[model samples]
Target chain A: MKVRVSVQLKPGILDPQGKAVEQGLHGFGFAVEHVRIGRLIEMDVPGADAAEVKARAQAMCDKLLVNPVMEKASIEVL
Target chain B: MRVAVPVFPGSNCDHDALHACGTVMGWDTIPVWHQEPRLPAGTDLVFIPGGFSYGDYLRCGAIAALAPVMADVKRHADQGGLVLGVCNGFQILCEAQLLPGALLRNASLRFIHADVHLRVERADLPFTSALKAGEVFQVPIAHAEGNFTLEPGDLADLEARGGVAFRYCSPKGEIGEAFVPNGAMNGIAGIVNVRGNVLGMMPHPERVVDPRLGPTGGLGIFRSLAAALARG
Candidate 1:
């Protein structure tokens, strides 16, 4: 099974990197807006069960991949 | 005082912290690896230093926050042990929920490196006992993400409880809009817990401890902590 994790800064947390990216897009005249950069992590797990895979992924995130204070992460198993 | 400095993979400030505590403060400072399950015995102080831990992967301080050593650090804080986090260390403290708020990327959207002024917002905390409230001093901050932010209620709460330790200031010590260097919310640059045991600040005091580096105010942090430890 493969699990994908997406980590984003919590709603109230200020995301300067996202803001800068938004500004950069404007500077480039992209007409694009509302950009927020997040991390996408993909991992291979031994379990074939989707629930098991997601659980393990979350455990990894909590242990080393994500910072709970400023970020919230979602996991999808395939 | 016995100081424990955790060395996360890629952490570069462990030596700096150790030298400051071991040499300058004349304390037994232990450099604990992230994999360690607990701090060495008789630890009076714990320091998380600045560096691009785990290559700042996932997010700044994200990966390192979950290291085994953090559990012990959290326990130490719960037991009222003093914890001082600087720069990246500040990010880790916030990640661990030991401190409120988060450090966002710099306002200029670039890494900032220079000496900036800070006004002591709370001198009653053990972290700032040597300084007086409203006193302005200089410290060097080198990081891409140093802009501090907190929820509206939390920000007010921190101020109301006198947990705010420092605020950006101008050379002349004038505060408010003109002094904040990186546009941090409410001019916050550092803070401590209500218990006054944990302190998280963006400036690198260890880098400025030596007079040859330009400012001595930075050295005062370690000196104050050392004095408190010695007293106990």
Candidate 2:
């Protein structure tokens, strides 16, 4: 199974990279706002089924993929 | 005073830290590998130095915080032993949940490399025992993720508990957003753990601790630690 983990800063946390990108968009005459920057981690996992794969991915997030203090993560198993 | 500095694969300041502790301060300081399950025997202090540990793959200090030697550091901290983290070390302390807040990127989205003034908030703690509250000192800060962040409630609690050890300030001791190098909350430069035995700060005191290297403003930290440990 192919798994993807998307990590983003929590809603209330400040994202300086996001803000800078937003400013760059504005300078380029593009009408964009609330531009947030995040990271994506893709991996291959072997499991009995999709359910098990997702469970395994979520466990990874809980263990190290996500930092509850500043980041939130979503896992997609494909 | 005995200091143990754990050397991660990408650590670049282990020598500086060891030099400051072992040479300048004439203390028993040794470098322990990250893979080591335990720190040097009878470790009195664990000083995590600055560097791009584990290549900062996941987060600044996320990977290094989970190194094998960290478990013993946690145990040592819980037992009221001293721990001081500088720059990348600060990030590790936060990532390890030994400190209260997380260090975010600079507000300008730049890697700041400059000397900034810091105002000592309280002199009663072990980390600042040789200094005086309201005293100002100059130290160099070089890191992109030094802007500290935490939930408002937690920030307030930390402030009320006197956990803030140093706040960025002007040469004359004026503190506010204007003096802050990174957009840290309340212009905080350093903070201590709840028990006051652990300290995490973005500035590189080891770099400027030597008197020959200009102002020895950073010397107070090592001196304070030596005094505090001696008193015990």
Candidate 3:
């Protein structure tokens, strides 16, 4: 099974990169009001059941992929 | 003093650390590889130098924190051994859970490389024994993900435990928004674990240890380590 994990800075944590991107969009005459940058990780997990794979992926996020203190991660079974 | 400096694959400052600790300070320093599963016997201090460990993959220090050698590093720390992490090393310590908080991207989203002033918050710790409280020192800081962040409760606990060792401040020793290079919480530049043996700081003390290099303000850190070892 394949899993996708999206990791983002927790709310109230400053997102400077996202703000820079928002400013760049404004400079280019785009109407992008708010921008928050994040990371998307796709990985192939060895499992037959989707539920099992999702759980394993979530575990991965908790352990290594995401920093629990500063980030929130959501896993999707693909 | 026997110092063990672990060299990760992408570690760039290992030699500098060796020079500062081994040559300048004349300590018995060993450069251990990350692949090694054990630290040398009688290791007094484990120094993690700054660099782009594992190319900053999966977040700074995330991958390097799990290297084979880290098991021994964790063991060493658990036994109340002294560990010092600078810049990238600081990131690794946090990732390894040897220290509190996480270093995030700079508030400006840009890599900052410059000299900043630091205020010694607590001088009683082993790392700051050479400096007095409220003293200011100029040090070089170069990093992108150097802003330290932690949960509120944990932050309070860290403060209550006297874990904060250094704080960013102005050249004249005033701390405020104008002096904070990165948006670190409470302007913290360095901290110690609850055990007070491990220290993690964003500034490169090794870079400023020599007077010819720049300010020798950083010499106190190495001196403190040596003093700690001598006292033991």
Candidate 4:
């Protein structure tokens, strides 16, 4: 199965890179209120079903895929 | 006192640290490879110096934090041995959970490199014993993700316990927004572990030991460590 993990900095944590991108968009005459960046990581996992794949991806997040201190993540099985 | 510096694959500052502790300070220092399962005998301090470990893959220090020798490093800390980490070394400690908090991207969205002033928060621990509380010293910091962050409750708890070892400050010792180089929380430059035996900071103290090179603010750090370990 192919699993996708979308990781993002939690709200209230400043995202300077996102801010820079936002500024760039504004320069192009786009009226964007705010912008935040998230990382998309896709991986292939062996599993019997979607539920099992989700659980396994979540385990990866628990171990090293996501840092509990500063980032949050969402998992999807494809 | 004996010092052990763990050298990771991308650890560029290992030799600099070894030079400061071995050649300059005249202390017995050895570089321990990351594959070694154990530190050399009679190691008084484990100094993890700065560099883009593992090419800063995934995140700074995240990969190196899981290197083979880290179990021994954690054991050394668990046994209450003194440990000091600088720059990327600091990131490794945080990633390894040897220290609290995470170092995020600099708010400026750029790599910052400059000498900055740091205020000593307290001098009671082995790491800062040579300096007085509120003393301001200059040290060079070079990094893109030196912004330190922690959960609100944990941050307050760490503050209340005096876990903050140093803060970005003016030359006259004023800590505030203007002095912050990396946008770290509360202008923190360094922090100590709950046990007070481990310290991790972004600034490179080993770089400024020689007067011919630059500022001598970092002299106190090595002096304090050596003095504290020598007394016992």
Candidate 5:
């Protein structure tokens, strides 16, 4: 199974990288309101059941892939 | 005092830390590899030096926090042993949950490398005992994710417990928005655990211990550690 995890800073936490990206977009003449930078992680897991794979992916996010205090993570099973 | 300085794969300041503790301070210092599951039997202080541990791959200090040595570090900290985490080590301590809060990217979105003034917020703690409260000192800070962030309630709790060890301040010791270098909340530059044994700070004290290299303002921190160990 293939799993994708997206991690993002929680709302209200300052996102300096996102802000810099937004500024760069404005400088390039793009109509951008706001942007929040995040990370995407792809992994391969050996599992036949989709539900079991999703559960394991979620566990990985909770344990190591994401820091709960500052970021939130969502897992997608492909 | 017996000092154990752990060296991770990318730890650059381990030698500086060892030199400060062993050569300069004349303490029995040993370099412990990150793969070791336990520290020396009589380790009194565990110093985690600054660097891009694990190449800062997942996050700053994220992978280093899970190294085998950290399990022993936690056990040592739980037993009231002294642990000092500098810069990237500070980030690892937070990641290990030995310290509160997380170090976020600098608000300026750039790496800050400069000597900044800091105020000794609590001189009575084990880490700052050699200095007096409100005293100003210059220390070098080199990091991209040195901005410390915590929940409002947690911040209140930390302050109420006197965990704040150092705060960014002016040369004259006045703390204000103008003095904050990396946008740390409440100007916090360093903090101690609830027991006051473990300290984590973004500033590099070991880098400033020798006057030949730079200002010796940071020597007081190492002296304080030595004094604390001597009394025990």
Candidate 6:
């Protein structure tokens, strides 16, 4: 099974990378109004159970990958 | 007084912290490697210095938080030993859950490297006791990720309990917005734990130990700790 975990800084948690992207878009004369930078983690597991993969990936995020206080993480099994 | 500065992989400021301890405060500062499971005997203070620990791989201070040395640091803190973390050291303490909140990237998205103005918010802890409340000092900050964020309830509790040690300030005496070099919520530059022994601050107090190079903001911090140790 393949699992993908997407993590993003929560609202009210300042996102500097996103702000820079917004500024860059304005500088390039583009109409893009907003951009939010998030992290994506892709991993492969031998098991075929989607539920287990998601649970395990979520655990990985909570324990190591993401800081729960300032960021939210979602895991998708594929 | 004996001081221990834990050195993690990529920790470049352990020597700076050690130098500050020995040269400025006249304590025998010992540099402890990250793999040590126990701190040195009769250590008065434990300092986690700034650097890109673990290359800041998963997140800043994430890997170092789980290092063997932290177990000893946690034990020392539980026993009321003074623990001071500066810059990446602050991130390590937060990641270790010794302090609340998380430090995110700067709001401007640029590596901010400047002598910032800081208003001392507390005058009791071993880290900030030397400065009076509302006193402004120049301390240089150099970090890509240094924005401090906390929940509203936590911020209120911190302020009410004198846990908020320092705040980012402008030369004009304003806080938040332009005064905050990074978009740190409420301009919180430093904080102490509920016990007031564990201190986590983004500013590098170890960098300004001498007046010839810059302002002497760093001296107050070391002096505060050394004085506290002597009183014990």
* Candidate 1 lDDT by residue in tens digits, B43-133: 9999999998999876678777889999999999999999999989999998888998878777777888888898888877767778888
Say which prediction, candidate 1 or candidate 6, comes out ahead on lDDT. 6
Q: What lDDT score is found at residue B119 in candidate 3?
A: 96
Give a tens-digit lDDT track for model 5, residues B125-165. 77889999999999899999999999888999999999999
Model 4's interface RMSD: 0.7
DockQ, cand. 4: 0.85
Q: Which ten residues in a row have the lowest lDDT in candidate 1 chain A?
A: A62-71
Candidate 1 per-residue C-alpha lDDT over A6-77 given as tens digits, one digit per residue, 9 for 90 to 100: 988788776667888888889988887667788888888898788877888888887777665567899988
Best by DockQ: 3
Q: How big is the positional error of residue B100 in model 4, measured in Å on the Cα after superposition?
A: 0.9
Model 1 chain B scores worst on lDDT over the 10 consecutive residues at B208-217
CAPRI class of candidate 4? high
List the TM-score for candidate 4's chain B. Answer: 0.98
Which CAPRI level is candidate 3?
A: high
User: Against the true two-chain complex, what DockQ does each candidate achieve?
Assistant: 0.48, 0.79, 0.89, 0.85, 0.78, 0.69
Listed for every candidate in order, the interface RMSD values in angstroms are 2.6, 0.9, 0.7, 0.7, 0.7, 1.2
lDDT of 4 by residue, A1-78 (tens): 999999998887888989999999999999996699988999989877999889889998988878888899999888
> Candidate 1, overall lDDT?
0.84
Put down candidate 4 lDDT per residue, B1-232, tens digits, no spaces: 8899999999999998998899889899999999999999999999999998999988899998898888888999999999999999999999999999999999888899999999999799898999999898999999999999998998998899999999999889997899999889999899999889999999999998877766788999989998899887
Clashes of each: 0, 0, 0, 0, 0, 0
TM-score chain B for all models.
0.96, 0.98, 0.98, 0.98, 0.98, 0.96
Alpha-carbon lDDT, every model: 0.84, 0.92, 0.92, 0.92, 0.92, 0.87
What's the TM for chain B in candidate 5? Answer: 0.98
Model 3 chain B is weakest, by summed lDDT over 10 consecutive residues, at B208-217
